[model samples]
Target: MRPRLPSSPPAAGVTRRGLLIGGGAGVGLILAWALWPRHYLPNLTADTGETIFGAWIKIGDDGHVTVAVPQAEHGQGVYTALPQIVADELGADWRTIAVEPAPLNPLYANALGADELFETARDTVAGRWRDAHAVRIGMMVTAGSSSVRTFEDDLRQAGAAARVLLCKVAAARWQVDWQACDTRGGFVFHGKDRLRFADLAAEAVRGSLPDALPMRVNEDDTRLSGQSLPRLDAPAKVDGSANFAGDVRLPDMVFASIRQAPGGSSRLVRVDRAAADRIPGVLQVVTNDRWVAAIGNHWWAANRALDALAPRFETQGAIVTSATIRAALQGALDTPGRRLAAVGDVDATFKDARLITAEYQVGLAAHAAVETMTATARFADGRLELWLPTLAPAMARDAAAAAAGIATDRVVVHPMLVGGAFGANLDHRCAEQAAILAVTLKRPVQLTWSRVEDLLHDRFRPPAMARMAARLGPNGQILGWRARIAAPATGQEVAARLFAQDAGFRTALALTPSGDPYAIAGAVPPYRMPAYAVDHHPADIGVPTGHWRSGAHSYTAFFTECFLDELAHLAGTEPLSYRIGMLGGDARLARCLSTAASLGGWEGGIAGSGQGIACHSFRGSHIAVLVEAHVGEGQAVSVDRIVAAVDCGRQINPDLVRQQIEGGLLFGMAAATGGSTGFTRGLPDARGFGDLGLPRLADTPDITVELISSEADPGGVSELAVPPVAPAIANALQAATGYRLRCLPLVPGTK
Candidate 1:
């Protein structure tokens, strides 16, 4: 929701002001001159004015408040939710609030996200400042559900500073004590004489801005933060006015379609470029070492020409298939791995007690966003400009510059609205391809990947395999627990892809035993045990892998929670009771688990059906899920209802929170039931949606989400509800069919 220019021209003699806020070094401030309304400002300042506050808030002569949101919005309501925090603090009229995406400056970097990146650095002040500086300059990414959690304080402070400035200006203009004046609903009042912010804008600009201000804490104020404000971007999206990357149109723009190699290990052998150029409306054929694309007047023509040319690719080294991948993972599990966590003597406890061991496997999964990967690039005057949907615009800018063989500053990235991004937009291949094609063609080029190409070329969720062993005491109590997981090191892979030349990141990766936090995120069970140990074996399966929705927790939770369910059954106890018994002191997790059970009617088990429950805590939030499912003929499972209880600290917008929980549950259900991508001879087997079995509308179950209200700091809600779904459904399936399904998808005969 970028700010829109006024429809009419400004009145003559009106002064205009462009407020530019500055931060530490390397935090570039985009000039606000271009954002001002042309007709509003009378005596405009030619030189930009500097303020101590961050570059987020801008007040215009017309009393319009514009907020620069650092996070990319992809139907998550960030554009609205963030502004709500600001408007509430400023006591401004919500109708006058407008939101625009912030520039790729370090000033808007996510502080909380930076903390996650440099956890080891937290102990030292210099290290903490270094991490903060990294976040400020181009490391500003919108991932890990950090949009709201990280920026809430900054926005509130910014808004409060503006309010203080306006109130001071109004009090001085009226020759009254500032303490007697109050600001509310975009107006300054002095004992009943009210003045609109618009009338005092000029005087307010001359007032000194506060370096820092205490944010007002009013739990009862429901106008902004706590209320379910309608999403500002929703109207545009529903009315088809929303502009996505695919909707970008430029003068002399040509469409291009690519035919990529199977995986990173594959190479393009040859392509009939001349034949492709001969096709009707085809402009030119562009080829690199690894892939080729056809530029044409239209996307369909380019796509047809690309298909007509039919580039050939060959695998570089060893051919990898599903069977070969599984064997390699199993082999890695058998080898000695780096121990991530250890407590007490697990070996002795296991030797003295009964052992229950099981191995689980999860296949590679696709992002499968509705919008196909797309980017529009224009090269002119020795500079490049790109419009695309990306979660990491700064990273994309760097990658595009490298691909275009130009200086990073010469490239400008304009992030467009994304249709969806379940961590698929983290890679900048689309932007790189578009830039290269634009440079080669010497014109504006729009490149798009067809559904088949997008699915096959995606940086898929890494395939994982886990082996779990639990030692049980004579009284059905858990004595010891051990887990070993083997999967592609996603941290190493992402580091190599995004920061191959970054010495600091490389050193950090080398210093840490586990390559990435995602490698063993949830490998160790949360429940307390006398002796517990977890190990991770990093594997290179010759397939391109990246972060999925929940990252490593996506599969690790499935493995650990399902194994816990197995242990519960072996102990002849209900899943809920078994979990409660183990959760001795964790009141948060216990509350979520019991709340979900109560709402789901755990005690009233339905005849001809069974219910299962699972809980997990990650990303500073706790969640529990209970699923009621029925098994039909031929072992087909249909979920009747799903109940979830979430404790994400304090709530922002209950409606949006519920939406995220429901969406995450459905997404996880798709993965649990029958969503996967297979490989054969180093090539993806599933070409499109027809083969990749995603959940349909009829498959959606009745979902109920209950959120716990607490005064604790807010946590992420986007991916918190997904991790427990697969295990909960699997447990329910076991209850219905008397079969223990360990692997994902729960396909028949895999029990």
Candidate 2:
């Protein structure tokens, strides 16, 4: 039976009836009564003495309140921050709170992110349904730093509803009005009369729920949202009990190692199956069009078998070389491309002014996560089960079922903890391959990509080039700015491949939206420019590119900030004051800049001080970075210190915010100094971490981050710090050496 496509979401908080009217696609919406899923049955399994409360809460006999967190734990502290929300709203003792991975269900889907990724702005019936029921159509991914922002309200409501139910049960037993009873520290209280929630939880689910759930109002003494709770996953990690995807074990599981076409393109031409079979401990060799895998009881044996097989692949066209990529981008920029952002008449503003022009280039950067791709699959009775480190479990299940030749409902995905970041876990090649291996071998299979294979096939951050031309006038007040960037439409491809509801819709999305705003997101400066235009010259690099640490801002920030420094120099003004002056309305961003400068010991980017400053706004978060570095005798850039100020607003865990900022700083530093590679004969020159020039303790600078206080709603912190570091370091180096470097992987001797 063919799988059914998702229909339009319900209207007015009720299920939609009739049909979905998409972009000329006459697809009918399913009847609400048949598949509304408005009321979801609890999917979490309860342990002995534990009572289930809806889909998110479970209360054990000993008073432990466990909250179900749906996002994959990827060192972002979702397990801790999310559970903190539930515990705070439920008025439970922090010590009594625990967390479990939420079961895969529509109730736990990331609908907002899915809708925002690709939903059309056509104002049609499909457009109306975009924000709702997206997970039923697209996927439940955990990227975009949206876990806290998208799910906060839902988690709060779930906790509040549960608390109300528990309070009512307690109030009934105490012979008091339920409205007069309040909960705190895992107990219900009414004028000095109290009872443990554990004692009443068994009967709470049966109580009459109010028409409207009451959300918590956090005041002085009862708020946990701002406190720095100890990370819930820390203890398990230290004790080596955390179950990463690689740690999953099953009865009679076989290990598989695969060899795909190198250089990210090819079809398997031939392989020596007999040689692979002769290898000691080798179970069998499975070959597909795109890759071949060797299965065995041990990974090492399987890897050796793969090596012995010596698979060969054939390429149809000229392999993408660095020269080709450069030529493609240069040609695109030379052409009159689509303009995505315009503040005023840039051509008219620049007509009579002497423009300060510069060109900057950034090379390809890989995700380079320490953990490679790993997934476990077991198939039996036409049903497939997968244990994988993935942000999109629903997407994985749907794709895996297809690969295994089974119905969509016959698949279940048990998401495991991952160290995946920068979109490493978003790919489904491993899951698809594992499912195929399991169905063919008639046994359980666990596949792990070797580091070399991981590097060779990783979806890299697209290489980009920007030509910046700015007109600076008297007093540095009158200015015109134009940035023409050439890069791949990464976000468009992501939307088409991962976010569209069906293949037909995906195809339509990929073809349309020819002008991609996401490709040139940060090209426009935050400063006050009289006239400015940001244009995107979409280049077909003939290589795969996906979301990096900061999306397009990773490169665009470097482009904008570094150019701002050049403009400041041309105008003979202090770089810090010049940027802050342009920040007329963004007080929050200006504060971040000022605070970072103070923290780093502001010295005006002087000749010897080696101080440089950069600030940016991303994902509703504002951040400023300052770097102190020097170009040494051999042109080697040595970083001494890095200081950052962030205003993410309403911290769930201040410690986590600080950690993310710190981590982003280090990741950015690596990218600035060594996180780039060039393609040669369809393969990247950097093959491993050693090749990428990762910073060690000795090479790392002393880093400090300050979290600004704000009562505003929470903003994303994970990728906020990444975009500004490169430009800060580059500007600092220019201040020290009196020379400018316009390319990434800043080699001081280059121009």
> Which candidate number maximizes TM-score?
2
Reference-based lDDT, residue 707, model 1 = 92
TM-score of each: 0.90, 0.93
lDDT of 1 by residue, 223-263 (tens): 47777877878888999999998898999999999998876
lDDT of 2 by residue, 541-575 (tens): 88888777777888999999999998888888999
Every model's Cα RMSD, please?
8.3, 3.3
Per-candidate clashes, comma-separated:
11, 3
Instruction: Single out the weakest 10-residue window by summed lDDT for candidate 1.
Output: 38-47
